[model samples]
Target: MSELCRLWHVTVTVAGEEVEPLIVRNALRRLSDQRPFLHSLKYAGGRAEIQYWEEAESLLDASSLALRVWNEHRESAGLPRWEVVGLEVLERTVFLSRGMEYHVIVDLHDVTPLPF
Candidate 1:
């Protein structure tokens, strides 16, 4: 099968509980810096948005990379580990478009005591 290249809108959300917007913004910035693929990083409706190119050898690889980013960010950030309930990476591709779209959601719940 031929490899397909597409543009992706990667998103990570820390939802379920109220968090200071400033904190989220700072975390997003740091996350962006950790991931070189992200560009034009922004936030909307409590979600971190980034424009990236899914140029990995396979779609699975691309998705895996997104997951890794989420895990890494969560581990590094002073956030509850169990608070994260979901991590989603959706494809928002347009027909006949040169690249496919991607959206990732990292859901978080209320703060909890760190077990580690």
Candidate 2:
């Protein structure tokens, strides 16, 4: 089989209240918690992001889970919708950690943003 690697780095931007970002962050945390396979979300380059090892076996499933959070909170967040401008797929080998970091979202409430 092809070497499994989907070290996805997704960025989402919300178009409403400042708390909107938190909504997305929290949802992602919950998602990672539920699936245990999907890693927690992160913030980078003025966007909320995440990286996972594609343990879901299907990138589409991973992508859907990311979008699902926005759908679940669209109404209450006062957000018309969130925009996923890009899902930056990269070679897993690029990360110094060598993709050994497909970890669960630990604490979204206090995650520092990764420098762009």
Candidate 3:
């Protein structure tokens, strides 16, 4: 039996040329360091966005982490602060028919938490 694990997907957007991939990666690392509950670091699109998984016990906890990362970058002047535009339990099952991988569907919880 496959073990059921809670996962979270985080998407961060920054200008193509203005943002450095290393810096963004560092930021994600910092976030993960600060909160050890998350795992996996998959970066894509010229440092434009990143997605990772987290052991989210609830939507609120997951949302908090997302908000923190966004604010941290904004506070550090890493990127123009973008509000929590959207978040929700990702319902659709994503699969790569021709790849060495397996995919898991997560409960996407959309959150537009008020800025702190």
Candidate 4:
């Protein structure tokens, strides 16, 4: 089975009004439908503000999808300026947890044991 990881953060500002997180989330969800890799969204800082994004895959896919969605909506709606200011990768490591750090994102459907 193959595993995927995605994480990112973006900031969008309204020209003259406060933005809403729900709006951003909905927009992101719509983008996810088209991209299929975006997993979820998170909120921080304050209301009508986005602190970060937890994507299901990688920054490349997440950002690309988000940028496209934002641009499309921006051109049509003409409300807020959607901007992605930051993108980052979240890596895993074996540490004091004493367990495998990686996880399965999709079922492998394999029953054969690996030969060491």
- What overall lDDT, based on C-alpha atoms, would model 1 receive against the true structure? 0.46
Q: Highest TM-score among the candidates is held by which one?
A: 1
lDDT of 4 by residue, 37-84 (tens): 332333322222222244546656655654454456554433246454
Alpha-carbon error at 115 in model 3, in Å?
29
* Candidate 3: residue pairs that collide: 87-109, 87-110, 88-108, 88-109, 88-110, 89-107, 89-108, 89-109, 90-108
Across 13-82, the per-residue lDDT of candidate 2 in tens digits comes to 3333234546555555554555454444565433555444442335565566655555565555333344
- Candidate 2: regions farther than 4 A off: 1-17, 20-22, 44-46, 55-80, 94-116
How does residue 62 of candidate 3 score in lDDT? 59
Model 3 whole-model lDDT (C-alpha atoms): 0.43
* Clash count, one per candidate: 3, 0, 9, 1
Between 3 and 4, whose lDDT is larger? 3
In angstroms, the error of model 3 at 90 is: 5.4
Comparing 1 and 3 by lDDT, which wins? Answer: 1
CA deviation > 4 Å runs, candidate 4:
1-17, 44-80, 90-116
State residue 65's C-alpha deviation in candidate 1, in Å. Answer: 1.6
Residue range 1-116, candidate 1, lDDT tens digits? 24565444443433445456566556656656666566544443334434444555555766666655655777565432323334444444542253332222222221212122
- Considering summed lDDT, which 10 consecutive residues are worst modelled in model 1? 107-116
Arrange candidates, best TM-score first.
1, 2, 3, 4
| Stretches of model 1 off by over 4 angstroms after superposition | 1-14, 44-46, 77-116
| Per-residue lDDT value at 107 in model 2 | 52
